[model samples]
Target: MNLESPKVNVTKSPQEVFNFLEDIKNFKSLMPENISKFEVLDDDKFLFALKGMPEIVLKKKEVIPPNKIVLGAAGGKLDFSLIGNIVETADGNSEVQLEFAGDFNPMMAMMIKGPITKFIETLATNMPKAI
Candidate 1:
């Protein structure tokens, strides 16, 4: 399954936004209010648990400076990835979009689509203030 957010503009420059995201600790500001727990495991990983879901381990998989950040699940229970795209605007501001992709059986996809969509959408919308 694949989900994507509408591109949104942020007042910050791409480099500034990228810098904030490069530091895993800054992710808490972008999490949903329902998140029950969030912790940075190290420079490239973080663990979080939502109200009714199991803890998910996310590892920073790839980075293309000032442009992209790729995060994916670890520990093998689920296979999913979250990609953040940042583009510099003519005015030096930034436009950001988020893509969420998961490999799951049809039944599993049906069960989690709603919550997953809400999660990524929330992140994208919160980006303007997250940095």
Candidate 2:
């Protein structure tokens, strides 16, 4: 399954946004308010538990300077990647795009589609405020 969030324009520059996301420890600021627990395991890894979901560990997978950042589940049931693409605007601001891809069985896909879609959309929408 693949999900893409709407492009969002943020007041911060692309480098600023990319720098913020490059650090896994700053992810807590982007999480939903319902998150129950958050822990930073290292500079590149973190664990977080949502209100009703099992704790998930995420690790930074790749970085493309001020252009993109990729993250994946460290050791979890779900095999997924979350990618952030940043484009610097002429006005010195930034446009960000969020993409999520995961492998799942049909039943699991049906069960999670809605929540997962909403989660990604929420993340994209709130990212501007987070920076």
RMSD of each: 0.9, 1.0
Q: For candidate 2, write residues 36-122 as lDDT tens digits.
A: 999999989999888998898889999998999999999978999889999999899999989989999999999988877887787
Candidate 1, residues 1-131, lDDT tens digits: the string is 99998898999988888888888788889999999999999999999999999899999999998999999998867999999899999999999999999999999999999999899898888989777
Model 1 RMSD to the real structure?
Answer: 0.9
For model 1, the stretches where C-alpha displacement exceeds 4 angstroms are none
Window of ten residues with lowest summed lDDT in model 2: 115-124
Residue 41 lDDT in candidate 2: 94
Residue pairs with backbone atoms closer than 3 Å in model 1 (clashes):
none
TM-score (C-alpha) between model 1 and the true structure: 0.96
* Best model per TM-score: 1
